[model samples]
Target: MMELQKASNGIFHDAAVEGGIPPEEEKFLQHKDDGSKRPEFTDFEGKTSFGMSVFNLSNAIMGSGILGLSYAMSNTGIVLFLILLTCIACLSCYSIHLLLRSAGVIGIRAYEQLGLRAFGQPGKILAAIVITLHNIGAMSSYLFIVKYELPLVIQAFLGLTSASEDWFMNGNYLIIIVTICIILPLATMKHLGYLGYTSGFSLSCMVFFLSAVIYKKFNISCPLETYGNHSVSTVTSDDTCTPKYFTVNQETAYTIPILAFAFVCHPEVLPIYTELRNPTKRRMQNIGNVSILGMFTMYFFTAIFGYLTFFGYTEAELLHTYSKVNPLDKLILCVRLAVLVAVTLTVPVVLFPIRRALLQLLFPGKSFHWVRHIAIAVCLLFAVNLLVIFVPNIRDIFGISGATTAPTLIFILPGLFYIRIVPKTQEPMSSRPKIQAACFSALGFIFMIMSLTFIGIDWMSGEMRSLGGH
Candidate 1:
């Protein structure tokens, strides 16, 4: 047990070595800090700040999910979407609360490790499998964005014809180039702390996207064709202009699932907690709060404005809806580039958790080694790029994975882990926290079954359902 703790310390020890501390001393220091502070402190004092942790976690939560949100809003209506989004956000926070509490009680920081502590090897393997699938969905989805959008951005910048068959315009080749030049370097980093700046920059791009969405709402007045002329060509009646407060349509079945997976950052949570500076359960939980709140605001505004601009005509991908106005429109082109960059940079942030889960499951006794790290990153990228390029129906992968894995990460695993890891003597089965956790786990089961049922019905009806075209 003590040896495993040392190996875990070694996994995160790359940054800690710069202080001139020997490996033995570092191991001893980790041991001292393990359970010495309080049961609340799940992590040691590292260099990552509160703001940076928020950025990393926030970046994880924000993804292709944002691109499809306005579409979700369009189907569910403004009022109903807000109600659903609020519930998902609050539930995500409570889910994080459950994880932090479970980790504090057990002093087990890795998600897989928590599973191991709870239900032995089978539990740990369950977590590892979930993370591998979930992040693979995430990383491929990001590259999927790059694969589809990079060519368009390149062509827009180069003033080339959209149908041009130039190598530079080939999305397959462009994804390869981006993977080699940009994502590979970032994903190979030893710790999540290093990606903070990239995360912040990625987030800044999304803010620009949000600003553009809001600006275009009033600027691109309805009878939406005027978006091409940049002038108000049609002054329609109030009925057409006013927002829909509530509506029910066939697409409504997929809206909640779309919004639900938007917050699937649970895999990244404990990894960030491990790298956090002076992390306590309360402090880490606060980080989750601020990040989720920021994204909630960004998601709501982006949806509301994008919906207002197009209303009922909004497409599955909001940017594509804008493309109808003018695909070559310069501002929309830049907006496409912004979304592309945001998701591209997000690929690396998603990689860390997957790498960690693989390491724990595959090389539990091995100390951190650069060869292992680089090999995993390179291999992971290669396979994901292949998946993105070769697979025409990548959304099915995301749809099935998102439907099953999102709820498991957000609700099921954390709730079950809390129940199993916390001692029955300390927190009795009938206690408030325990009762709440059991209910939470049960809710996860219900959500999973409901999502699958709706998705199955959609498929049976010959309407394929995917979360935001991922």
Candidate 2:
């Protein structure tokens, strides 16, 4: 019986094999560039450790959006926010591990490659589209942020209120920020290998911002004000009601998902894994564990502090939440200005992978130094910024960014890859579930529905508001 079982296993193993491709050579098949082409990871020069890898992950995870998370959580109440955070953090750990495990099996360096390995050509194409859409949406949101906020800084400096309304319309400032701050640094990088330092710098800015917020909240005794007309009203025996927890409802729930979406950075994990020093399964797990915990801490604090500072009075526009929080104090204002600049600088770092992935997807055979790819990326980024400046709508941005793209990239794909690739034996040890893949896919589907629904609702709301002249 043992001999029969061994023979059956042998046949199955051989059946799984393809042609004469050894396991080592099959790693290259993950790239599947027809042998005439090679991937960037083919010549990987590793310098990352578990600590540095966590730092990079944390930095990428903590981007410009951390500022807005608390405002989103404000209406939801602290308890609700904490619940969501806990759920997402645990989900993040499982999903990240699954992604890393997928990468290890196929030696794939990007999320798209992982899809290709598991699901073939169609899967690759779909993954590429999801990532591209995600990048476009995220970059557009960042552009809108710069368009709205940077002009205020300039206006304050010039002491001119007249220049404000025309800022996004002109778009030249947006162009400058996109080109000089984002495109140029990314373009000049001889290799993506050295961007870890930039990641380090970005993480430093995150720390600085958190510290500044904490200092202000502790030193100052400012209490939060009420937010929105609908803010939490309760009925009394006299038929009068008081507001509770700032009038949170389903309509105001848009910010909650958007906040979750903004905090995610799963797509960026692939590069860090490839860059790891030993690049072992153990090291990867360690990095994932520490990074998620670190980011959760960072985000939790940022949310709490932002909530404390603005309290229930926080604006729907997250940045304004900061702007209204007694910037008259020079120390606080300086910190605010510093954080803004830091986020502005870090914008380019985020742009790197998005640009690289888009370029590689379209031109798989092309080398990293291909000038045409750079030109195309630059052109597209330029056009995106232009559109963002001219047509800035927070609801539309969130619909595309958080509701549609974030869930697929973060939760859905990881879960799918785990089910597809990870063995059941390994799964039990790792503590990830086979059923989670289905659940994650379902979550992705729900997110897609939510995305479309949000888009429709936003449009309807806008029309009604136009009629009402809010």
Candidate 3:
């Protein structure tokens, strides 16, 4: 098996660079064109600056996945969760480094193009499939947040009772209204670079969310000591909050994959790279590093504060936890609105890569068409809305999407492409780069296997619980 794998690697390496400039010389060439015509409808050389690019990429990295961190911490506890999150962030940075380096050496901007260069048709198709799955799942998660959280925000603002049956209070009706009003218009934009302002606003909203979590951590009283005290309100029990530092169990397997999913911005990486001003490996690497570092800090604080606030009782969606704890808290309500706006703006950013992947797969060599772009965007939003309406369990979607697609895109593909494109002549098989690539690929494979196993176990347990309930 090892001999066959080695032979396969050599074949891919040889085929990947057959017509391209040599690896060492490729980086030195001023312009390494792929000989493809530029799209007439969309300008490839966008004027996105270093700071704006960081904001856009940071927005992409931090999405609905952040909402589940408290729940993830509930499983792994504070210490292990932090350690795992740090390791995943490091791996994510390294994977982006490999991608940027490979793309720079080859002068290929699009992810599908990189895949084509690395492993031919199959590689291109695989990239498209993963991008499609991952982005669709991401968009669905954003819409899921909208569908569930939006109604409560409305109710809190209006002082509507749970018994209210008004059409305006209906979650389905509200999601549809918001989708048409907000998401559709944004998703129709041609270039991602134009959405930089919206991305920045979305990121700011998330900052407010983290702030609210931190404030509530100290303000909200714990309910444990007054569990059976009829006179004490759970929301204002006056009990001191206690935070767990470390714990582990079968559920720890699930936490890693969730953290892995939280950092997945790979599909958007190449697109952002293509648009970056003064595009180069080093500049793009800096963009990725700054963005990941910012997000890493945000995720760490959000998870720590949120977990500290709720400890053992953190729900899968932190917003839901907040709503259940204190529906009338003005600050919590504002946090909900901020998150709603953030996720609503984020749908389009996530949508761009999926649309690009579809165009690359189905309309290869064709220039961007407005009709096709609008049609694809509409169809994708429609599909995502349907899933959000029907799929009540966000964690299940998060698990499946993270387990199946996140690792492949974040770790496996980038590592393999780095090894394939950089020839042994340039970076020997026993070199540091190859060793790191091997370790990265191994990590991805391990995460992939563990995620799948955990998903299967959860599914069976859920079914048994359902059967017993019946």
Q: Write the per-residue lDDT of candidate 1 for residues 266-384, one digit (tens) a residue.
A: 99999999878777778899999999999999999999999999876677788887877766678888888988889989999999999988988887745579999999999999999
Candidate 2, backbone clash total: 5
Off by over 4 Å in 1: 1-37, 40-45, 226-239
lDDT of 3 by residue, 78-100 (tens): 88888988988888899998887
**What is the lDDT ranking, best to worst?**
1, 3, 2
TM-score of 3: 0.85
On residues 400-445, what C-alpha lDDT tens digit does candidate 2 reach at each position?
4556677788778887876766544456534546776668768767
lDDT of prediction 1? 0.81
TM-score of each model, paired residue for residue: 0.90, 0.77, 0.85
Query: Which residue pairs of candidate 3 clash?
Result: none
Error of 1 at 450 (Å): 1.7
lDDT at residue 210 of model 1 (Cα atoms): 96
Query: lDDT per model, in order?
Result: 0.81, 0.59, 0.75
